[model samples]
Target: MNGYGSRGSTPGQGRGFRPRGGVGRRPYPQDAQEAQAARPRKLSCPPELRDAFVEARDFLAGLIAALGLPARLGFGGVDPARDGRQITIEVRSLADAPDRPDERGPDGRQEPGDLAILIGKHGATLDALSALTNAFMHRNNSRDLFFSVDVEGYRARRVATLRSIAQRCATRVLREGIALELEPMPPSERRIIHLSLAANADLQTESIGVGSQRRIVIMPRDSAPPVEPLEDFE
Candidate 1:
């Protein structure tokens, strides 16, 4: 059996669940999927990159097992992301036991015994792992190495969701001719927002704030809100 990273979108809570970010976000469409901005695309592990890809795959598998998490790794192929290529491997849960609360051993440090822990509150740990792995590879390899670690297919699904949300927000921004702010997101998520809106000329997107407080604001090409049509009164 396979479960995606973090129990983000629950079965019944899909309609209500929004990846809550910082407070004070103005109302927008709850269903980002309806925006139709994000479309799924496939990537292949180029033969030239196979050796490098396998190196990361084996490293993460051993690390997970050493942590007492027996997982099956799936190579998600490499894709262009940021400066380097993004290589993702899906870590599937071999055991379906419910996530256990963080516990400290004799040393007094919390141990990772569940896949959920790898995902963190809002994928903090997951993002960290991606950074860590890339750093590890960079030190070990002469050529540039960029790797993104994901539990199951969370990264794939997340990419789609982010694209959708971006499109939804961009749609409203264009229609209302008003600038809108999205909840705070990590760099990877924010990247998705920016890439998703790159094709739209009527809208402009930028990141504001610093560190964890950083978020995206989508604005129409013009600052002033567009005039309301007479159709509203009729």
Candidate 2:
């Protein structure tokens, strides 16, 4: 997920738009009632693991309180199985967020004021929050954790849009015989592009850039020889 660099070009004019996991499979989780029936009172986790999630939830709650933002959150218990070597945390803002665009400053480029502050330039704030949550979990649990914090449904909608853009770019790259350089995107979004194009034999892809300026470059697959055996890998 961290393959791509941070933010890229504005997604608005990319010509096309609108669009997780290992083993290519993730099992369905049991309902709370059914799970309780199957494994009653098995919710106990190591204190460290338990606190990792708890502290994360609490930290966000405290932040909301400190900012005087009205939000109601229900802390569903954490699943130890799902809480692995890396703790994964998810936060959703109960209140609907307003759409505020960037404003132009004296400089030519528009300065992202509130939106940038909220998302943190290049999503750095969100990333830092994630890291802090992971650190707290790892320090107590002695295991690393991966956390994702989403304001409203931003992350979900972003993923959907990225998938569509990746597909459209892939198609264009195949047809034009010219490489397409996408606007910088988060590492997770880049992963979506990679996965979307993984099966296409007609095209080859690679990401280029540094930090938040990184973008994915897609081009036609030359009639090249096999790099490695498919069976040797997944």
TM-score of each: 0.62, 0.56
Q: Which residue pairs in model 2 clash with each other?
A: 8-184, 9-184, 19-159, 19-160, 19-161, 86-144, 86-145, 87-145
The sequence of per-residue lDDT tens digits that candidate 1 reaches over residues 1-234 is 221222211111011122234334333342443222112123456677777777777777777777776665655656654444666765655442234223322222122336655676446777787776777788857645577776634555456656766776677677767677666678878888899998888887878889998977788875745322111000
Q: Top model by TM-score, which number?
A: 1
lDDT of each: 0.57, 0.46
The deviation in Å at residue 137 for candidate 1 is 2.8
Model 1 weakest lDDT span, ten residues long: 7-16
- Sequence-dependent TM-score of model 2: 0.56
Stretches off by above 4 angstroms in model 2 are: 1-51, 74-88, 94-117, 120-124, 223-234
Alpha-carbon shift of residue 188 in model 1 (angstroms): 2.8
